[model samples]
Structure formats: structure tokens, C-alpha cells
Target: MRSIGLILLLCTSLDSYKILIYNSKYGHSHSNFLGSIADALVDAGHDVTSLIPVMNPKLKDGTENSKIIRIEPDQQVLDSYAKEKENYNYFELNSFNPLIAIFMGPKFPKKFEYVCRKVLDEPGLIDRLKAEHFDVYISENFDVCGTALAHAIAPKTMIGSYSSALTGQHFSEFGVPEAISYRPAAYMTSLDVHSMVDRAWNFYASLHHKYCFWFLRLSINRLMKERFGEEYPSVAEQSANVAYVLTNSEPLIEFAAPTMARVINVPGIGAKTPKPLDEYWSEVMTRRDQTILLSFGSVVKSIQLHPAVKAAIVKTISRFPSITFIWKYEEPDDEFAKEAAAKLPNLVLTKWMPQLDILAHPRLYVFITHGGMGSTQETALRGVPGIFVPIFGDQMKNAGMMEYNGFGKVFDKNNLGDADKLTATIKEVLENKKYRENAQRISKMLAKKPFSSKEQLVKYVEFAAEFGASAALRPQSVDMSFVTYHNLDVILASAACIFIFVYLICKMCSRTAVKLVALISGKTKNE
Candidate 1:
């Protein structure tokens, strides 16, 4: 009996895995996605080690089996980031311009390289990671350094990538079919309806995405060669070896694009279960006759808004004295923002607020958001309508999708200075019953999936860990040349064959005509 018990314990121990999650991005949404996955793994009796940027706040709570390592940025990188934020202009581009955004994509690899360098500079960090013998490595797909670190630390481990959305080009590299004609790019604000003009733009955007990703991979490869020697695999190669990809988008919100079997859509992984509001916030929500939560997400704070725009928002909110507005202003100490908040009796400003909790509140009427994916998904999950004022990145796309789904209304950020337009739009959405009803319908649809996002995520992750890489799942198209994969060669050959056949027929007809003419001349001579 003792021997059998010991064997059962050993089997259980063998089933547990050591997992490594690398997310170096500074954004809270990115960290939250990774943190949620780590938490899930820990709950499933697996050991998790997360390497995240120090700039992001720590995860809420960690179990004893889970460990977090904060990778600090280089001093120069920190200074540059601060300076960039200080001089940042939110309205420089009219909207999310694909050309400009594609050009900017390559710049991220340099920052990622800097972070990797900083990690390597830490004493004994590499050696310690090597000793851990992680069974699997999950990396943020946006940053190349994560994959590079995975290769350097645990070469034999199963690798997977997590993305906040379906990056069409990245998936294309793995031979995933792209629905560029009808599906809009993540950075594009267009809807899924494909008019000729829309298709043209989509084609252009797809090409631009391809170029951007190629450049990014080249940049990372050069950095890897410079640092880790010439034998190191390129970022593209590393990505090709990945066993699975987890995307934080669903077909209901994302355009209906066909994805590979290995690509898992876990749309609401960042969405936390709505907890009861804290005492102070609960009282605040109850005291107000109606409440609106306005947040621009973590990266873009309300205090960073242009002075004119800020004034206009304040003036607009002041018009509706019956409704309370809770703004998540990152710099609550700023005198200008403070003065603006004080202008309206119903306005409340705080450096931070429980956004998800507030969205779940019974009295919360609407959410005024920047249309970030995390915010969009959370609001959709909570069955809340929104007023989206998208600024940059995928926000414009998310806004368009939200409006198309009838869950929200989008107002251009450039029009924020027009108080009348902004105020009227807000009032229109607030007064409309269809928006709330639509949001509720979407929430129901989102909840109708067979398995929850967390459940699917854990199941696939464990599957990948148990069975190494899923090479057989990869399509043969991945190994084919671009021209061959598209069948351009076959098309050109068929065209050539038709041309040759037509030439031969024309030559025979000409010869026959010459013979007839010669015969007629001979008959005339005889006469």
C-alpha cells in the first residue's frame, strides 16, 4: 500500500511543469494578460516564473508556486521614454495611419534589444534561468526579445506567443490565410464591408504590414547576432518554431477571419471577475443619481489631454449636472486638471479607479473610453455601452468595431474641442435605448462559448507542454516560396502555353493562304 501511494505521488509530481512567461512591454494591459495566464497555471498546480518589465505594476496576488522577475529598463531608455511622453502630441495624426504606424513598428525592436541587454547585464541572471529548466516558454508576440530570451535560456522548451489581437501578417508568416478583402487591419478604422475602395485600402494595408514585420524581424536578427553571436536563430525562425499562438480577440468583436488550428482566440483573458466595489467607491456610486466612468486606459491619461480638449470635456460634462462623471486622471496633482475637475459639482477626478469594478456597477450608466481592446472587451463583458474617442494604435479599429456592433458611438478626438458636438453626441448615446440593448446582446453572445477563455487557454497550454512542438499542424504552405504558394508559376505557365498554341495556328493559316494565292496565279498564267 505504501509503495502504491508513493508511485501515485510521483506520477502527480511528474505532471506538474515549470513554465516561464516573458512580457517586457511596459503597458499594463499586456502585463495583465500574461499575469492572468500565470495565475491560471499556478492554480492548475504548475510552477510559473514571469519576467516582466519593472515599469508595470505588480500583479494583484501570487501563489507560492509562482515567481515574478521584474526586468528594469536601462537608464537611457527610461530617460528617453520620459522625454518622449512629455513631448508627445496625441493629435499629430488624424487617425491611426497605417503608413505612419508601419514605419514606427521597427523602432520597437531597438527598445526590446535594450531591455534584453539590461537583463544580460544583471549578475548571474542568465545562469539562474538556465538552472530552472523551464518546460515551456510563453512570450508576448509584440516584442522580439521575449522569443530571443526563450531561445537563449531554454532552447528545448516548447514556445508559444500571446498577442492582444490577430496580427494578420504575423499569422501569415505561419501560413495562416488572411481575409484582407473583407477583414480590416487592426490599425484600420474601416468596417468589414468590402467596397472596391475598402478592398484597395485593405490590400495596401496588408502589404504595409508585411513590410513592417519583415523589417522588425531583420532588426531583431541583427541585434541578436550582435549580442549572442552569429549562430543564434533569427526572430523569424524562432517564431516559426512556436507551437501555439493565443490571441485576445474573438470573431464577435474581431472581423471574421479564418485562423490556423494552432491559433487560439481567448478574447476576455484580461477581464477579471467583477468583484464588489470597495466601500468608498460603492458609496460614491450609490450617492450619484447617474454615473459615467471616463477612462482613456493606462497608457494615455486624462491629464495628458490638450488644454483646449480638457476644457471642452469639462464644459460638456458640466452641462449634465444630474450625472456624475468619474475621470481616471493619472496626474490628479496637476493644477489645471484639478481646476477643471472643480468646475463641475458632479465631476470626480482620481489618479486611479477600479475600472472593471466600476463597469460592473449597477448604477453606472455608460463608459467613456479610448476604445482600447482591454477596455472594449471589459465593457462588452459587463454589458455596458460606450462613447469611444479613439486616439491611436488599434483604438481606432476597436472603436469602429464597437460602433458597428451597435454597442458604442465613436467621436473623433480632433472634434473634442467642439463642445456642442461632443455634448450632443454624449447625450444622444445616453438617451438611446438601443445601444444598451445591443451591448447586452453582445455580452450574451460572448458568454455563449463552450469553454471559458481561461479554460481553453490552460488546456491548450498544457497540451503544448506535454507534446513538444506541433510541427505536423503547420501547413505545407509555410515551407513554399511566395510565388509557388500563390500558384503564380502555374498561372504563368498556362498563359505561355496558350500563347504558343495561338502562334502555331496563325503560322499555319498564313502558309495555307500563300499556297492558295500561288495556285490562283498559276491558273491565270495557263489561261
Candidate 2:
């Protein structure tokens, strides 16, 4: 048909620009996410270069049609900041992945400083990146240095973070709903319960980020001024204000904030291409059996699970014969996990399992997760209910949001006891139709977008590269005073201050009146 020919002609005329992605010094998931974006861009005829921390073997083997640049930060500098002992938070130094602590939120600031130092000291790293002459730079928001690198270069920057705008990255300033803000622990969101908490978290995080921007600007200006004769003009303003944020999420899974206009929800970045069910998993999905996929994600293996928590899961799942539990663990030789696997006929434990592949299976009835954003997005994508046991960082917030949407349940990892309670919750998710219906409804909404979410990411990056700046959805001109945003508290404080001032003035005047009366009475006594 003429229409088909014209479509082909239009596609042929569209040119792909050179794109550079930077994701260094983070978990494997972030690297994989960047790689997926790069792969997508390359497939779309774009010249793509990926900059990642030199860790996994897969990263070393550069993919065809793409140039992969590895940055091995100076080991000496890394060693200086990194704990000599194997601190779980700095686990990336040990092997292909980093060991995230049970409490990852409090430790992030130190990690940020350590990463920043590495970016500055690495010889030839910045120069090599500059040499690429990239038109656009794509990176995760947590990689502050990556954003800085993109700013240092003339290219446009698009941020892709696991935390989304919840961490006060983009949407917080733009009046996005606060219920999605970052939290220290994991919990489920109940529509009637946690919306207020979410809003409070967003308010704090927004202010925190505003402070960060000011601090970075001041530091950069001071550093540049000291080194060069002139004040740093680049530090004077945000570089291009970010064309838009490329979120690795679907809006249907969660209520997207004011950022809906700027967000490009490119879900399933790390997932395998959707294909025909291979029969093995499909067969498993059949029957009246309810199923659950349990994993902490690629970075944190199930083997690292605290023994008490592992025992709780084992004991809980043992009681349910009709429900099947699949735990993606990493101990091929560990006898403990194997023994548990042997003891529980209803549970399937494996050294490695394809998570996305499993979640997509029709039999997947529920997800027991650590509340990682990527995993939550996948859970939402499959229209599967979940039980959230957040370990640390923003996992709590993710879990809380899911609970709020009525798609999941959340519990604390620190006090994760009572196998009976967990088992009961699992049974509820399986038996109740509400969870399934809500999840399906969200899935439908996520699928309504016109194009692949990554395409939006690509378009924004191209626009930024072509146009020097993007109109910031969250403008920097707005007043950040605490009094202005949350006015009731300020009004109360002002009222109290005025009352005290007036009372003091009146007391002083009354004392003066008493003194004058006393003086007049003394004159009468003298006469």
C-alpha cells in the first residue's frame, strides 16, 4: 500500500544522533539499565557509547554496533575511602557487585563522597569522555558525577535513576504528589493510610535537594575560581536544566506526579524480550496452584539473607501446600539453603533464576520482594500482587506506595518475625480477587502509551543535544523558604512572636506609669 511505503520512507529519513551513557560506581542493575537504553538507541540507528564502572565480564565484552568505555577508578583513591574490611555497603569493590547493607539509606552520603572523589582523580577518564564528542549524555540520577560529566561536556543530559523523582530529583520541585518520596525502609501503601506520610517525605526531600544544588554550585564555583582567573559561569546555572527524566517505570503501576509531562516510562529495560512461553514455565503456571517469586534482585542475592529472616520464610511457606514459592538464591554449594529446599516440597529454591521470565509467567500469583524500584516496576508490569519486606534505602517508600495502590502488602525487615502472619498474608493475596483486579487495571493503563517509553527518553536527549537547554519543569526561581511552602507552621510561629513582643512593650509602659504615680505621691507626703 502507499501508506506502508510512505512509513518506510519516513523511517529511512529519520537520523539517529550520537548518544553517550554514563553509569559508573553503582549496582549491576543500574549498569544493565544503561546498557539496555544504549542497546535500544543503537537498534534505532543511533551511534551509542556506554560508560560504566569496570566490573562484570559482560561489561568488558563490548556489544556490536556500540562502543563501550570502561572507567576503572584509581584503586588507590578507592581504597582510601572504601572500608579496608568488607563493609556491605561498599561491596562493589569486592567483586562484580557491591554488598548493600540491611540499612542502605544512612550510608549513601558517604558513598556519594567516595564516588565523587574517584570521578575527580581518575586520569584520562574525563578527557576520554570529552573526546567522544557526544551529542547527548544519558545517566542515572544517583550518579551525580555522571550528571556533572555531562555538564562539563557540551552535550545534553537525561537522568535515569532507580528512585525516580521520589528522591527530590525532578518532580518534587514541580508540585508532584509527595506520597512517592524516598524513605529509609520498606512498607506497603494503603490508599487511606500512607498518603500523608508520602507527602511529608517529599517535602523534606525537596528541600534537601534544593540545598544540595546550592551547595554543589557554591563548591564548584569556589573550586573553579581558585584554579582559574575567572568565576565559574557553568556553576552559575544548571546545565540545560535536564531535557526530561527517562524513568524506568510505567505510570499505571504508580500515580505519576506532576512529572507525567516530562517522564518517559521505559519499563522492562533489564528484562528479556517478550517471547512465546517456552513451555517449561508455562506448564508450571498451569493447575490451581498459586505461585510467588521471591528475590532481592541481582545485586543482593538470597544467600545474603539474614538467617532468621530466611528461616521465617522457610517455616511460613512450609505450611502452604497449594501455594508454590520460588526463591532466587545464589548458593550453589551452601547446604543451609539446600536443606531448606529439600525440607519444603512447596518451595523451589535455585542458585540462579531468571526473575523477569518468572514474573511474566501466568502462574506468578504473588511477589515477595525487597521493594527495589526496578523489581516493583516489574511486579506491577505483570499485574501480580506482592508482599513487600524492604531492607533499606528507598525500598520502604516503594513498598508503601504499592500498598497505597492496593496491589501489595508490606512488612519491616528488622522485625520480620511471625511466620504465621506472613503465611496468612500470602494466602490472602492468593485467595482475594481485589489484588489481581487492581494490578490488571494498572497494567492496562501502563500499556496505553503511544510508543516505547525509551523512545521518549531518546527524543528528550536529542532535543537537549540540539537545543542547549530545556525549560525545567520544576523552576529554580520559586522561593524555597520553609515558611512559604508549609505556611501554617510559620503563621503559628509568627503569631507567638508578635504576642510576646506586644506583651513586653505593654509591661514596660505599665511600669513607667507606676513610677510616675509613686513620684507624685512622694511629693504630696513631702508637702
Candidate 3:
């Protein structure tokens, strides 16, 4: 009776916090990542509120479970955003240019600064947030507005959430450790950090990424100061003060680097468990002996694919008459896509797809993907081999991992027009039994981890709420200057000491030799 009573008391005494998760409802991956965290917290019995801004109209729901408050940017911002997006082709070669990043990267966020301005100016919203007295505040670091919103709320503990793998910003601004010697950069094609050439390229790419990211962050910071008074802290300053990050990076699969204790890894935090396929999709998967699903993710549309590339893909899939190919072609009116779809009886064209449901299908043999982290992480545990076609940014790095892990191969984007190459690569993955075996092995390993991603997330949140900004976990190197951090100052000092020591010894030796010569000459004269 006493033991049972003690157990009940312990359970009752455990804390349930009021958590405010700010979802920047624009990018599918970013919003989905934050939304999942909100739902997870709510499921864990915390009070979770989702503060969302309508960055993209398509992604309307910030979170499925949390209490919602939507921020609508003025029509000017919306009009400008919609205008820019209408013409933007994210898959273009120069979309990731550093000069463009430095110059025009902030232009979009600068416009969206109105979202934060509106939030702060609203008396009712401010009063309601203050009333909540949130124990923990979490927001995506892609935009500084979300982080700035944390300042207004003044939550007990503030945290930065990364939807994808942490980049150079996490190392330079926050306390996550990154090394040029061994860690791969997200922007480059090379994944193997051990090779000298790869390391050198990584050094160059890492510097480029850091430089570009600096300007991006700088632009956002200046915009914050311009909109809100100078009293607001810089985004980097706010991130550092948090002393913790919840990232959607899987340690088991990601390129190994030094990571702080506070930077928690929860890979599947945003992933939904695969639900049973509906009748239409279930019937389609079983229609063929094997199925191949081709998708370029939400941001990178299939319609933007070069006509030659589309022709090559259509030709390659046509070679396999037994395989049922499901292609997520975003546009219904593409004349070539429509013509090819009609001729190829096995090919199915979709403007939208239940990608998760399709990937989980038993008959699904392979996936041709854009290597976006959201899809990559979700697909990795499904035991399906893929041909990764990376478009840009971290996607290239994500594609390289497919080959690194031996479950799949990285297809060169430049060779997409070559039907022969495309067909050969697809055939290789299809014929090679080892690819399937390796994928299954990795899936089982990921599934049998010590704890689930949700448990890791919940425990870390609880710990952060109780004890904010852990100095012990934060690397002192985060604040150190380049010279200091690299030990170059200490190296120069040691070099100077060594030079002086050698000079003194040489001088003594020369003096001794002169004295010896004089003594020898005198003795010879006396004799």
C-alpha cells in the first residue's frame, strides 16, 4: 500500500509545462517540422500553443493539435511574396549563388518582417501570450521573426529548432562543433571527408556557406533592428542564450562531427507513421509486380524539369514494362508529360501524391527522389533503395549520403538528359540484391534504437524547462576569435620563443669559438 502510494505521488509531482512553439508557416519542411514538435508536446501532456504566420497560403495549418493563433502579413508583403514565388524556379543552377544570397536573400525576409511587427503591435495577442507565461518557447531558426517573437513573450527557457541538419550557422553562431578536416559541407557534392581532395573542397564549400549564411543572418538582424527598436538582441545572440537546439538530424546516419550535449538529435520528430493506403492507391501498387515512385518533393517541382530530362526519364521508365512508375508531375497541362503518360500504359501522372503511403507499400521497389532531408529521413527507415537526384543546397549532401550508406546511388543532375545513363542506373539498383539487403538492415537498425525520437524530444524539453541555458554543455569555442580558436596566437608566440632561443644558443657558440681561436693562437706564439 505504501509503495503504490509513493508511485502515485511521484507520477503526480512530475511537471507539465506551457510550451509555445512558433511555426513559420511558409516552407513545407520547416512548418511541418515545427508543427510535429507542437503535436508531440501536446501528446506528452504539455500546454502547447502554435503561433503561425501565413508565409505560404498552401500550408494553412500550423499544427494539428496545439492552440492556434495566425498572423497575417499586410497585403503588400503577401503580394510581393506571391509575385517573387510565381517566377522562382528553385531547381535552377544559380539559385544558390552566394552573391544572390548576399544581395537578395534578405529581400524576402525583409518584406516578411511585417509579420513580427503585426504580432508585437496587437494588444490582444500580446496580452494573451503574457497571460500564458509559457515555461518553454521554441521556434524555427530559418527566420529571425520567430526568434524575435520569443523576446516579446519572455518565456522561461527559449530554444531554437532546426528542421534539417545543422549547418555552418549552428557552429559559428551557436555552440555546435564543425570541422573542415572531417565534416562534409551541406552545399557540396562530396560526402567523404576522409579524402584529402574532399576535405579541401569541404574547406572551400564550408567557408562559402559560412560567408553566405553570415550575410543572410546579418540582413535579417538589421531588419529586426530597423523594424523593432535597437533594444532587440541579434538572432545569433538569442540563439546562443538558449544554449540548446532540437535538430531533425539522425546521428546514426549523418556525417559524424563534434556535437554539444544541448544540441539534441531527434530525426523522426516531424515524420508521420505510415497509415494504410486508401483503395485507389492500394489498387495501383498491387497492379504491377514491382513499383517505382518518382518525386522531387514539394519545393522542387517536377514540371520545372528540363524537357530533355523529362524525355530521358520517360524513356527509361518505358523500358521496364513490368514496373509501375508513379510520377508526381505538379502540372497537369505539360503537353509532353501528358503525351508520354497516355502512350506509356504503366506510367501514372499525379499532381499530388500520398508519398508516405506509396513508399510504405510492399510492392514499391525503388524511389527516385530530390534528396530533401524531410523525404530522405522518412524514406531511410522504410528500407526502400533510391536514386537520389539532388537539386541544390543541403540536398546534394543528402544525395551523397545515399551512396555513402550503400542503400542507393547519387545520379548526376547533368546526366539527366542521357536516357542510356538513366536506364543503366535504374537497372543497376533493380538488379543488385545487395542494395535491398543493406536498406533492410539499416531500417531495422534505425527502428531498434535505444529510444524513440519523441521520447528524446520530450525528455530534452523537460530538462531545458527546468534548467535553462546550460553553460556546461555550450562550447567555449563558439565565442572565440578565429586566431584564438585555431591556436594561431599561441602558435605565433611559440615560434617567436623558439627563434630567440636558437639565436641565443648560436651566439654563445660563436663567442666560444672566437675565444678558443684566440687562446690557441696565444699558446702557439708563447711556444
**Best TM-score among the predictions, by candidate number:** 3
Q: Best lDDT goes to which candidate?
A: 3
**lDDT by residue for model 3 (349-416), tens:** 98988888788888999999989888888778898998998987788888877677877889877788
Clashing pairs in 1: none
C-alpha lDDT values of all predictions = 0.77, 0.61, 0.81
Task: Give a tens-digit lDDT track for model 2, residues 1-527.
Answer: 99999998777546667788776645555666667777877887788887665433333322345787665655543553444323453112211012322233334444444445555557867776677677777766555555555555556444434434235433333333344343321222333325776556455444544444444434444444443346334432332355555666555555544444555566666556545556665655563367788877655556655677778878888888777777877774588877887787777777666677777777788898877877888777778898887665556567877877878778665544678788788878878899889988887776675776667756766666676445555444232443565577889999999999999999999999899999999999999
Please list the residue runs of candidate 1 whose C-alpha ends up more than 4 Å from where it truly belongs after superposition. 1-8, 53-65, 93-106, 121-131, 155-157, 209-213, 228-231, 517-527
Candidate 3 yields a Cα-based lDDT of 0.81
Error of 3 at 349 (Å): 0.4
Q: What TM-score would every model get versus the actual structure?
A: 0.90, 0.73, 0.91
Query: Cα miss at 119, model 2 (Å)?
Result: 4.9
Cα shift from native, residue 187, model 2 (Å) = 8.5
TM-score of structure candidate 2: 0.73
lDDT of 2: 0.61
By lDDT: ranked, best first: 3, 1, 2
